[model samples]
Target: MATLAPQAPWAMRLVTDRRPIGPPSYAAVTLDASTQRARYTDTAGQVVKMGEHGTNQTNPTTSMSGGGDGAEPQPQTADDSTPDYSSD
Candidate 1:
């Protein structure tokens, strides 16, 4: 006999539209294996069902053309000049 493995849930934020104007909270998501549908459960134990408008994955507003916000800052090189401690 084979045992079925448990499904791992992921984090998701619900939004009414692409602008993300809705409840300011994140939910834990788990996809149904048989239905292949996603279920969202918020911290308050509320299960949100799909609305008549349906759902769409929104694209990120920010651009990552050059590493976006997390780009590492370039390090500055130290000057090779020796210390000028000889004050007259």
Candidate 2:
């Protein structure tokens, strides 16, 4: 299963036929980005095309927040392989 877009609530699935053969479990079908066409795989392992398809255009923000003074201190790992002999 794949999302129509980033953080989209609607999910889609790949199918050979677009027509409703039985009960449809998917909300929509996968589409080609460039041609804006509906795409699916046939029984012969070839891609099948259908009517034009479109989806909501979303510009996902890739920016991440930088570490600042308000940020919590990261945990420090201590090596325990060496045995303490000072108490001997």
The TM-score between candidate 2 and the true structure equals 0.20
Candidate 2 stretches with Cα past 4 Å from truth are 1-28, 49-88
Q: Residue 36 in candidate 1 has what lDDT?
A: 98
User: Residues 17-40, candidate 1, lDDT per residue (tens digit)?
Assistant: 567568745477888799998777
Q: Which candidate's lDDT is highest? A: 1
Question: Each prediction's Cα lDDT score?
Answer: 0.56, 0.51
Name the best candidate (by TM-score). Answer: 1
Per candidate, the number of residue pairs that clash is: 0, 0
TM-score of each: 0.29, 0.20
Shift of residue 57 alpha carbon in model 1, Å: 23
For model 1, the superposed segments whose C-alpha errors exceed 4 Å read: 1-20, 24-26, 44-46, 53-88
